[model samples]
Target: MIAVVYSGSHYAHWRLADRGKTVASFRTSGINPYFNDEKQITTLLNKNINLIHHAEQIKRIYFFGPGLASNELKDIIRNAFLTFFKFAKITVAHDIDAVAIASCKNTEGIVCICGSGTNAAWYDGKK
Candidate 1:
């Protein structure tokens, strides 16, 4: 099975699973004051750790989020995931790109996601 995880200013964490022809998904509220702060970041990490713990069948994990501009934060998140899910293969994808791909032919006109953060992309019929 494969697991896809993501977090952003608006969401603390989210997970999706692909199992043969079935798919499962869920989302959690973002820790308060979502940002680069230590407390909030730790909370987010804890949330991810919990999710990873329950997904024992997940062989791979794909993370989608904005690339951290701060190397310190990047290292922190990387180490946390490694410590929590040592066996899972992890990959990161740009948040905008994920949104664009997911929105393909699903909605008419512009597809936008907005909250504490925002993402917008045009979804034409052609792939």
Candidate 2:
């Protein structure tokens, strides 16, 4: 199973999929590393029934959010997920990276984001 998450300052959107079919989709409180610690993040995860039920079954996770501008910030979320998702290969990246991938996929394209903040980037199919 694979999980994809996109978080802003106010909410986190989650999608769990397996065999190219969606298993579940839901939302939780936002997970901004700058505003939340590892324990807080883990706590949020623990409260969600969807996550609790699927945690052990998920094999991969892709998380995107703001405030992951540095490796240190990314580690905050990574560490929290690590504690909860013991068997998954987790990836943490900037929310803009998500914009890139969504707009370009495996092709070259430019993406512009304008929500709470504004920025643009060029994706060469591989970041």
Candidate 3:
């Protein structure tokens, strides 16, 4: 099973997949205004635990977010995943990768995600 987790400006979302097929999904509101705050971090951890509880078959998790580029945020997220689901293999993915993949279907151009944050990049097809 594979889990894809993401956080937006107002909420966080997660998708669970088994054998390339999505099996379950979850979402929750963002509570903290700042990403570094302990309370807000705890809220994210709780949400992850809740999501994992519902998808016990998940064996690996692919985390996606903008703030994940920061080492501090990465540590926090890594710790949270370990605390909740120790057995699952966790991998952090840049938000840009998601944008690139989504845009690839259209053949070329700029793909922008203007939600809680913004990201843009050009793909030459060499990827």
Candidate 4:
């Protein structure tokens, strides 16, 4: 099973898939490592019924969100997810990387992200 998450400042969108099919889709309160601690993140995870039901079954998680540009910030999310999804491998990255990959992929291009804030990056086919 795999899970993909995109988190902004206000909410998180989640999709769980297994055997190439979607199993569950839901949203949870936004989790910003910059503003929320491990305990708070864990609490948020615990509050979600879908997560509580599928946490153990998930094998991999790809998490992308804002404010995760630094290793310290990334570690905060890594730790929280590691503890919650015991059986899953968690990969955390900045939202900008997500935008670059989704929009540019392997093509050299400039990607602009406008959300709670605006930013842009140049992708040379690979980061």
Model 1 stretches astray by more than 4 angstroms: 16-18, 21-24, 29-55, 67-75, 105-113, 119-127
Candidate 3 on 5-95: residue-level lDDT in tens? 7666476687877777877777866422235454555556565655646545667887666666667766666666666666778776566
lDDT for model 1 comes to 0.57
Better of 2 and 4 by TM-score: 2
- The CA lDDT at 34 in model 1 is 20
TM-score head-to-head 2 vs 3, winner: 2
Model 2, residue 66: C-alpha shift (Å): 0.5
Model 2 Cα RMSD, 1 decimal: 0.9
What is candidate 3's TM-score against the reference? 0.72
Tens digits of per-residue lDDT, candidate 1, 14-86, equal: 5555555335566765423224454545455566544645556566877666645456655545555555555
RMSD of 1: 5.0
RMSD of each: 5.0, 0.9, 3.5, 1.0
What TM-score, to 2 decimals, does candidate 4 have?
A: 0.95
Estimated TM-score per prediction?
A: 0.57, 0.96, 0.72, 0.95
Worst 10 residues of 3 by lDDT: 30-39
lDDT (tens digit, per residue) of candidate 2 on 1-127: 9999999878999999999999999999998988999999999999999999999999999999989889999999999999999999999999999999988999999898787768789899999
What is the lDDT ranking, best to worst? 2, 4, 3, 1
Name the regions of candidate 2 deviating beyond 4 angstroms.
none
Write down the lDDT of every candidate, Cα atoms only. 0.57, 0.95, 0.65, 0.91
